[model samples]
Target: MSHPQIRHELSKIETNLRIEIGQLAERKQIGIDSQGTNLCELIALLTNAALSDHPLFSQLTKLDAAFCQLDIGLYGLCSDCESEIEPERLILDPVEQRCALCAESYAHEHRHELRLTH
Candidate 1:
């Protein structure tokens, strides 16, 4: 697909997701007013919503913005070696503008940060 097409699609998804997230946030806030609810359960619900729903959707929005720039050829090249990013990797993760080598190095360097925190 063309760059404009990809960007347009991403934008549409981002807008829709933002609206959904806002609605969920409002609902969650309303839930806090419920009387006699278990405090642990309430905290768990809010934490789950923020960590899973909110962050997942928000991350996609950020990725969309970054990908839009890449689509216009502004950040399409890898920063490390100045090589063009592989099309396959880009297809897998459209927001990824780094080449394989640079990406691998980055992942290796930050491997510990990828672990799940509880």
Candidate 2:
């Protein structure tokens, strides 16, 4: 279908997915603290990891919004660089906010960057 239609569908999917994840988290917490502290700690760690990655889900939502805008002939316009992104790269990542060159350079600079510091 068209980009606008696809974005609308994606928004619905994202809402459902968020609800499913919430329910799953609730169910996961119902289980008791068996197998000692280590098991409990492990479960907490896993939960933390899941929550940490939740932003990617938000990013997907933003992508859908961008796609909606793109449907009105705004595709390939970089939000960061304010330049036309490559068509080839847009085909690869329709939700991308940066052009290939900018993306690659950013990735190279931040690949080793850590989000959480102890």
Q: TM-score for model 2?
A: 0.48
lDDT of 1 at 96: 66
lDDT of 1 by residue, 1-118 (tens): 5777667655565555545544665766744322233323433544655644456444554455456465467645675777887878766665665799998998887785666442
Q: List the residue pairs that clash in candidate 1.
A: none
lDDT of each: 0.58, 0.56
Deviation from native of the Cα of residue 36 in model 1, angstroms? 34
Looking at model 2, the pairs that clash are none
lDDT of 2 by residue, 1-118 (tens): 4666646655565555445545555676644232233322433544554653555444544555565566677756776677888877655555667887788878776765654332
